[model samples]
Target: MVAWYDPGVLAKTGLKSLLSETIGRQADRRLLDAVARPQPLAFDYSEDGDGKAREELWLDYVSDLGDGWDSTYAVASAVMAPTLEVRDATGQVHHTEGGDVLVFGGDEVYPTASVEEYQARTVVPYEDALNDRRHRPHLFAVPGNHDWYDGLVSFTRLFCQGRRSRGWQTRQQRSYFALKLPHGWWLLGTDMQLESDLDASQVEFFRKVAAQMGSDDRVILCNAEPAWIKQQVKPHAGRGFLDNNIDFLEQRILGKRVSVFLAGDLHHYRRHENTEGRQKIVAGGGGAFLHPTHLPRVDTRPDGFVLKECFPSQKTSRELTWRNLLFPAINPWFAAFMGFVYALLGWGVAANLNEGAVSAPPLREVLSAALQSTGSLLVAAGTLLGAIAFADDRRGKAWQKVSGGVHGAAHLVVALLLTWGVSSVAAPLASELQWSLRRDFLSGLLLFGGGALVGPLVVGVYLLLSLNVFSCHPNEAFSSLAIPDWKNFLRLHFDKDGELTVYPVGLRRVPRRWQHGHSPEEPVWVPDPRDHRATPPALIEPPVVIGRSKAPPLTLGTGQLAPALVTQDEQPPAGPV
Candidate 1:
């Protein structure tokens, strides 16, 4: 089943490769980031009724919902369907029907991100959600690694194309937006192409926007991934590259400090409130499988860095070795090598078979399949090896060598382990076959096949969580292994006094018949602290924490906006979310 040559498996490889090959790595980025300046994306707020409606801005946020599954989409829709009486900016708790704006933090689809994938995975589902909607909200999105797989060609078409979607449209022109919310809050969503660095256009656009920040202004930043989690594993914290950028953007670019930082690549509920009272939330659990919340070891925050992650916690998948990534070329080579050698053993058994000619034919087919695999194997191995050999090593960093060595060892270990695991199981299963060559050959075939698959399975899964492949998250029941977790998303209410509050909603549990059914029932959603309970190991202790002021707001200058997004009378949104 793990055979890397299968179409499904090969498709998996293509998806990962497309992320690095397309989008940010190509000319599209140069033109888009350089030529495409910020457009008129801001919306104007208006008042409506007297009782259930004092006009206020409210946002419905969901992330990583690009999976082509129906049930999870249903759950995401449910998270926003019910009209709730939310406290307005005036602190008046009134019933709010429908959403004023809808924001997808990043990752709009999966499977080698393309317009087609977005059409089917996001737009169609969103269309269905609107068809079932009590009120329609303007849809806006930022490109995740998956969305960039096609180099923002598809992303720009859907989001930047007149800022409209399936009849729902907004003025948000670029992949990023500086949305003017009520009060003094700003929604700063950037393209974050692989979190490489802020592009020239982005830097210039935000700098101008940042120049406008007033002393009372605050911001809600939508990040594409939870790069900090990876930092927990390696202390450099992505060598502080990502952290430095966040600080630079909030302090240098936005001018106003970030009150809330939101991301959704993890596909689970992880909220961290730093000592400074900034809310770092991960609510990716829109669909797809769920990732683990905790690792084998407990992570302790540095002094004065009191970080707390949200609930429904569990351990992350630790089966993958970093070595698996480097040994891609060698995987098939080793598999073919073992297959050929073992096929010989099968041959000898046939030549000296105590049984008749009937057993010889089956044994021959077994060897034939293996020998056939060798040709493809050799070609793949040679091609990959050649690429590696020629890979520009001028950047020859120390991490590359160490990482390469581990991959070499891990590939071998995974192959050998899989061979042994399959051999042990198959050996007895075929024991009653009169000790014929056919029995031994069949057993050997399984051993090789199983061994070959382990490398991709382990490596692919890590890529899914790390790079957010398939726009899917981890599964709590099986984690990267299997099974989907409860669907979830965030809803934020903005008030007049520069205060923002976020409420998390989730299904009680994922539907049992979800995968097979046509339209799964929209599961009932419960609020946090009661909606779910994770295992002992969690990302942080208090996942859904409330706000508290850490320090006084700084005095900053007012920004002059591009003529496109904001109206002449446009004002910034209030507070931090």
Candidate 2:
């Protein structure tokens, strides 16, 4: 039901994106930090006496949510569920209760942020999931690009104030915040805004938190975007890498104390570990469309980070990319729009020919007329420019633009050919049948039908080819599929012996069918058991352990571990585990 290819959806988001890049960027909302009253808890975290008082803590991390009901709600219900019992691929079972702290990594709402969208797509389902519970988890979030579309107004209103988001207690006073976890571990979230540029206030806030951290105290850094992966996929044209802000904070402010770097903008589960056992994870599959895990086509990063685990698998992601070939079937509304455009192109061509002439127009004239007409030229130019703009310009503007131009030309040629075929067929039929009155009308009708059938197919094939062959349009490629599976989030636990464990939780397929619950305590919408795709959550890989081991992790062969383990998100102590 959530079609990214829909023309209306495209136009609306496109306009908002334009506004965000131009007007929203000019007048940065984060500059209004003076408005927050500046809560003490926002910075200070020295009360715990260096992890001696507390024994353990749990926390949950999810990001890039708020799309359709089924997928988003499925994840929301799972995260808010009192307990989640998941198993690894080898059938090792693990169980975890809900966290005392819930961290939204970024992109809490999709398709342009608004209060209405946040309520409908994010709040309603989350509230319905756990509203009846007496104890509530504290919520913290960093803003992603989608959240920045409206200058973070909606995000600030909903999250910055210490209000309740129905079931969860909102605790952050600014867009970014730091929390002190048990056992000398800390969580720090950064708001890199639109340009990946941090404000002075944000830097000062983290610097204060860093000063309190002892030499052995570990930190978990949560960012909206996964700069490690983006550095390879879409690096800045001038700069070789894209993580300057993170590098500065990690080295200069945090003093390289960050043991884990977590993010969710990539929309899939991927974990990379360096030689020191430090983890970099991208677990963004929190309800929006799934992104490919097979991207960047590399097993390791230049910084010595090796790709250790990924959900949906790289092979599965490659196979999924092929689904875009059925574009018209996948997104019929977009196909209809393409059909309308072809019909208009046909009309423009016919208008150039003499209305009274009975003879069929030559194919050459049909093609020439398509080239000469002003409306037709506009259509051609629009297709080329739109495709070029959609291209991932970070891949080098000149080559990306040329590839996009070729993609647009494919669509243009197909439209022109379809127009000629319709005219050739319709003209002969009209002359033979002596149906003089409806000749032009019949041609117009044929053009619409043919274009509807073929236009979308062209675009789909273009996306498929561009992605798999050239490594382009990674966002556009998978978003067209709107895959509901491969949903994932992180559950982190800090244990008594000053060790941190990360569990990557994933769902193979979200339930499509739902039923309304009659009970007051239950979620309003529950996953219907009758749905074939309904299945239990599973662990994407072995639980990653940090702080105890400086060497690279050992491969834990598939086996049943006695103690069932999972992850959580929280700050300080809300309740005993």
Choose the strongest candidate by TM-score: 2
State the C-alpha lDDT per candidate.
0.52, 0.78
Best model per lDDT: 2
Model 1 CA lDDT for position 565 = 35
- Model 2, 1-577: lDDT tens digits are 3689899999998888888889766776776763544745343332344634667777899999998787888888888877888887798888777887899999998888999999999888789877564357788988999998887889988998888867788877788888887666788998986577566556666767777766677788998988767667776532213324455566545644778999988889998888877888999988999998777644688878899988889899989999988888989888888888888766778755636656767879888887789888887888789778766675687977898788788878888888777766676677787875766877777778788879888888888887788887778889999998889998887777878878888888989999987776677788887897687678889778786533222222121211112114312133221
**Least accurate 10 contiguous residues by lDDT in model 1:** 534-543
Stretches of candidate 1 exceeding 4 Å from the true structure: 1-23, 26-38, 45-55, 80-97, 163-167, 236-246, 296-305, 315-479, 512-577
Structural similarity to truth (TM-score) of each candidate: 0.65, 0.89
| Every model: Cα RMSD to truth | 10.2, 8.7
